[model samples]
Target: MQAKFLKSLMYEAQYKDYSPDFVMYDTLLEKNIPVVEFGSGTGRITLHLLEQGYRVFGIETDEDYQGFFLNKIKEKGFIDNFCYVTDITEVVEICNIIYPFNVLFHLNYQEVEVELNKLYKFRHCWSKLIIETDNIQYINSQSFRSKFNQNQDYFFKEFPRQSKSKIIIYNEVIEKNSLNIVLKFEYSLYLHKADDLNRIYNQIFPSAKLYGDFNLQFYRKNSPKLIAVCIK
Candidate 1:
């Protein structure tokens, strides 16, 4: 699927509201100075950080999302507070915090190691790194409907039959008036278990802490999300 079209549908159908993850990060605002967010889709979290007076640099791989993010921030008069980078290595070396929100899961185990190693190389530059990911055990392959606006809704389904290491998600936007599918797209992502994540990070950065949710609580077996906070 094209990045622009997928993002437009996602933003309208599912990402219109602030996520609970946002609230969780908000609590740590004071500690997240001069932040850098990886895979910052359409400036959702990036805009919030900029509005709160933080100097944020976003690293987005998608050209469409980068353009959309720049336009939105510019309109909000926060253009100066934010910068864009297409590669992680291009980021300025003085940032204190790094946010890899749901980006790690997009990579396979080997790829994740490479990315983590890259971040580890800059361990001395950044004091803290926050990683958010879906809890593989908590998610089930199923179909559901989500209400977007009064006139439209999204039908979501997941297929995990391909392999244990990955899942394919299918999304369709339906118009209520005609009950017709207006938009459809599918995307795939690699899956990572909590134990695997913990083992990987602990090996690289021994002091990394793992939490079950955004509330900063200890990781439970059944938590919906996995969050890792690594301090240098």
Candidate 2:
């Protein structure tokens, strides 16, 4: 992602509420174990976990997002409870929870397999691995505009027609006064079906459980998300 686009996303978080995935992970604080969150964008979930007295180690690939993430943790005075690294292989400490919240969707099938295999090595180190991703069946192409701030607005559109195996997202930010585009970017990701994801999970961790939503409900055809929880 571009730096400007990432900055816009960080701003979006100021207005938009936390996702259901955040709520789901927050409930696991009672486990009282250290957490390692992959793709910890802007430390949204990481901050919540840290505020709840749980130690969290964030792993993110994007340098732009990492800068904002670091600033937020410092601002909240939760720097002690949180730390971050740009590479996953650099994580040597054992954590009880592995959270890749809303992250797997960005990987292709091959990349997903590679990541799962790498994570499998830490099975003994972490008791649980929770992955949250889109339920491909439920994804639809749509467009809408929303307020970014007092003087700016963002127009978002998704076009999933380019390929059967991938989804494309387009984002644009415009200044209301000048009606000029301030930022624009396109993001694309491989589309993974529920069955395909579950099959991979079972192959790697046979004891994994699949849920359709944040409520821990059983998966179904029309569910909005496919959340997998694998226990060691």
Candidate 3:
């Protein structure tokens, strides 16, 4: 069941902008760094890191995706170079290693951030952390409920009228003042409105360097699928 959900998501994500592999590989090639990916789905970024001979570790919440990655490592006999964990909050236990090649993308940012915060409770561990996901605004009064009703009433009629209230829950948890902004760009088409996204970006990542133009990816050149890289 987990595998099915991930597979479906991957199939959908392929059409979006920003190949995470391309971004990570470019950074690694330039910096000569190793990697550790959290919320890696089916070793999508993990496999690329492994193929490049980068020591990689992955944390996956989905058991089926975790199993799939484990099987791949086993099949390739990469006992020393690659590691994966199923639990969301498992701390990485790499000794004497300075930096790891990092590529992470999870659907649930609130859950993943809590787990990652637990795993790396002490800061200054990873030299780099790359994340990709839907943009959720925080500490802002945009009335996402109005947006949801305006955009999704035809499909989500069965749900509560204030369905977008959940968006606030996610934003409050994920967009706290812990991470510094690095880079942010759009990726998906169906996730957010472009105007809302730009406004949120200014609020959360006011200092982040824009990686590419708003339409650099497949976002109809005007969508709200943002791809951002931030620092701690």
Instruction: Give per-model TM-scores.
Output: 0.80, 0.81, 0.48
Candidate 2, 144: how far from true, in Å? 11
Name model 3 segments beyond 4 Å from true: 1-24, 28-32, 85-123, 134-207, 213-225
**Candidate 1: where is the Cα deviation over 4 Å?**
1-6, 29-32, 142-164, 171-185
Off by over 4 Å in 2: 1-15, 98-101, 138-161
Task: Put down candidate 2 lDDT per residue, 110-204, tens digits, no spaces.
Answer: 99999899889756566677888877664444322223343234443322345566766565655555667666666666667788988898899
**With candidate 1 superimposed using the best TM-score fit, by how many Å does residue 223's alpha carbon deviate from the native?**
2.7
Give the least accurate 10-residue stretch of model 3, judged by summed lDDT. Answer: 149-158
lDDT of 3 by residue, 95-160 (tens): 212112222221233443454454345434544433344333332444323211111111111111
Cα-lDDT of candidate 1: 0.69
Decoy 2 TM-score against native: 0.81
Q: Please give the lDDT score for candidate 2.
A: 0.68
Top-TM-score structure, candidate number: 2
Q: Superposing every Cα of model 1 onto the true structure, what RMSD results? A: 4.0
Best first by lDDT, ranked: 1, 2, 3
lDDT scores for all predictions? 0.69, 0.68, 0.41
221, model 3: CA deviation in Å? 8.4
